[model samples]
Target: MARSTAMKAAGLILALLIFTFFSLAASSSNNQIQILNAERRIDLSSHIVKVFLTLKVENVGTSPASEIFLAFPPSQADQLALVKAQAAIGKKKKKSYVHLDVNPTQLPDAPNGTKYFSISLLNPLSSGETATLEVLYILTHSLEPFPTEISQLESQLVYFRDSALILSPYHIKQQTTFIKTPSTKVESFTRVEPTKFAGRELKYGPYEDRPPYSFSPVIVHLENNSPFAVVEELLREVEISHWGNLQITEHYKLVHAGARHKGVFSRVDYQSRASVKGASSFKHLLASLPPRVHSVYYRDEIGNISSSHLRTDYRKSELEIEPRYPLFGGWKATFVIGYGLPLEDFLFESPDGKRYLNFSFGCPLAQTVVNKLTIKVVLPEGSKDPSAAVPYPVEQHLETKYSYLDVVGRTVLVLEKKNVVPEHITPFQVYYTFKPIFMLAEPLMLASVYFLFFMACVAYLQIDISIRK
Candidate 1:
């Protein structure tokens, strides 16, 4: 009897949960939220979608509205990833920090693309009180191959699609989206009524407010021939030794994301096509180094690569590296490059008697996009009181590592950043102090060891105890 009662209780709880979920879903459909503006910018140069959505939401029906849910289509779930998201109260351009809860709940019965996300307002919206929120998110892989296949030398066309209306939990009042194409060679696109095209920009609509669950569709197709280089990871390291030198090294793992090459890569055909003015294949990366840096080295996972060139004596040094394989679409390559310079060039002693280092590092190649970047700075052992200032949105932390004859591990500053472009190669300032004793301790320790060894040898020889014994 007790078992039966427990089972009955469990069934009752499950029934209540199911009923509540359906009730909420029905209520959400009855009264919808409104979108005031939806502006989307597409950059083929970086293959990213930046969206700004201005929403006016309220609690019209009795209970307080704590949050709103948005979801992406199931078909698109595998192709895109969200890189950044934030929200602010009405027309707040400076962006208020809002943590988005992705895929908050799971419903087995829901449709295929039910990747639900939630946004919280600082305060609950009571009945009749409204709040406007500015929302922004970066979406990757916004384009897809229209033809699904292409020849090596032919241009590729990609297709893009978006909802005619912005997805919202509530009805939208007004919304518009302006899309800019990569090039002027647009082949086809959706022609919604009242749409306009000026140059490469396409404007969708200032459509009248839509009822709950209303629909519209926007699609576009455009031609592209540029080499799309996607760097999956970039690791940069800086070693600082007050003894006189600073070493910087960077490693890159990259993939070519342009149109797929239909056949095996041919050197003869490639060389002939590459000689043309504008070739789609990726050939080299250009790295910028300080002038007169003669200790630069470039290599891959293998021992050494000889296809690197260093041109110096100019305003700045440039390193041009040709990969072992000409990078075609869907191909991957990784390499490591490093250089050294005098520590005095970037070190300074402040009036407060503190030592500081201003260091910067970046890619040696041009027209490259880094998806993730992490830089580690290894300071000399026995250095103390560490602090750093990095010029990007990053997570900064410290690690410890030990090298030859080190009594204690050295302090390493680790700075990790995302979506790094070429311009992000800016300077970071690291501050630390070295005591007089610590500076002189290593040499003194070495001299004392040598002296003691010499004395022991002389003492053993002078005793000559072996002759008598």
Candidate 2:
């Protein structure tokens, strides 16, 4: 009887709380921001969701709007980079780019434990004023591997879960989401009455505006036979020379990031399977570099690999190489590739008499994912006060590194970065003043040494006769 009474008391308290919530909600007068239109584009070709959100927002509140907020689930915040944002103007839709100040806040009682970024507007919008925002970001590891592991001959399947109904803190006028699959083989998807499904594309809703914080979940399954390749570490070294050229070398520790094989890899079985149904494993990699790349070489810790080919023309340049061993799921291999480009193509000079060297972090295959990157750029022996302007966040250090004929060690700028993806393959410029006199110092010193050696030979020959007498 006591246990029953306790349970009844708990129920009575829950009922009282619900009654209080309704009573307060009915009396509340909350301001609403109306979303006029929204469009989301998801690129399924990658292991990430490259999302582009275009929103038209109107402040239906009584006061001016100074900021806007975007919410994401707690699980998706860590690897996301807010790539770009632009404010759109009147009918012609001209855009004036403005910098966004990102302020992140986590609320304890938020539905789904949502974490929001409050983007502060440069200019406050008046009530009833309309503005459009275009935002871009990549959601990494957004696809989940289904059946986690696959047999050597079986195809890979992945899953993507999102919402059919758009969820927002404010009321939405109308919204549509378009999903593009990586491959043409979309096996199945959630069959909801409000969605239209076509061959590789899924479209959801032209539904009427829904109340605040409403959502409906949807899921998709697809077959992707593409190799999921990742580099555990990529060490890129750049040496700058004032004479003519810039030399770049990269060492890669590569791994297949797809489903693991259930058993030991059998080459014979793989060959047999390839003859029947084309090999699903990674066979080759194509790396892109700036045009006019020369003296290209490929090797590994053991020795040189002969299976690399370089193609260069007026239009584009590419280096295609194959690993020593065929890369299957859970297998690893390492290799080094080096090339040289004209220094003028990447270096710049400032009117204030400073020299800047700019180079890309991109490898031959810029699309390949990398977990960590260490970049070292060696400046001239006397170059001083090295600083960097990079496109992404990085940790930097200055080290004394020397090369051939270097007396005072060159200034080596070491930049460390993590979680690199293809989209981050942008260039960064390292600035330092290179004194022109330093260029001729090495040549002049060599000439002096040759003159001294000639004089010494003559003196030794002239003194030999007197010694013999």
Model 2 misplaced regions, further than 4 Å: 1-32, 89-113, 118-123, 165-169, 184-193, 206-218, 264-279, 451-469
Shift in Å, residue 113, candidate 1? 10
lDDT of 2 by residue, 232-329 (tens): 89999999989889999899999877766565667787677653233446868999878888889999988989998888997668888999877766
User: Which of the numbered candidates is closest to the native, going by highest TM-score?
Assistant: 2
Decoy 1 TM-score against native? 0.65
List, residue by residue over 361-427, the lDDT tens digit for candidate 1: 4444566666777888898888888888775457889999887767788999888876665555678
Clashes of each: 11, 2
TM-score of each: 0.65, 0.82
Instruction: Evaluate candidate 2 by giving its C-alpha RMSD to the native, one decimal.
Output: 8.6
Error of 2 at 188 (Å): 4.9
The global C-alpha lDDT for each of the candidates, from Candidate 1 onward, is 0.70, 0.77
State which candidate has the highest lDDT.
Answer: 2
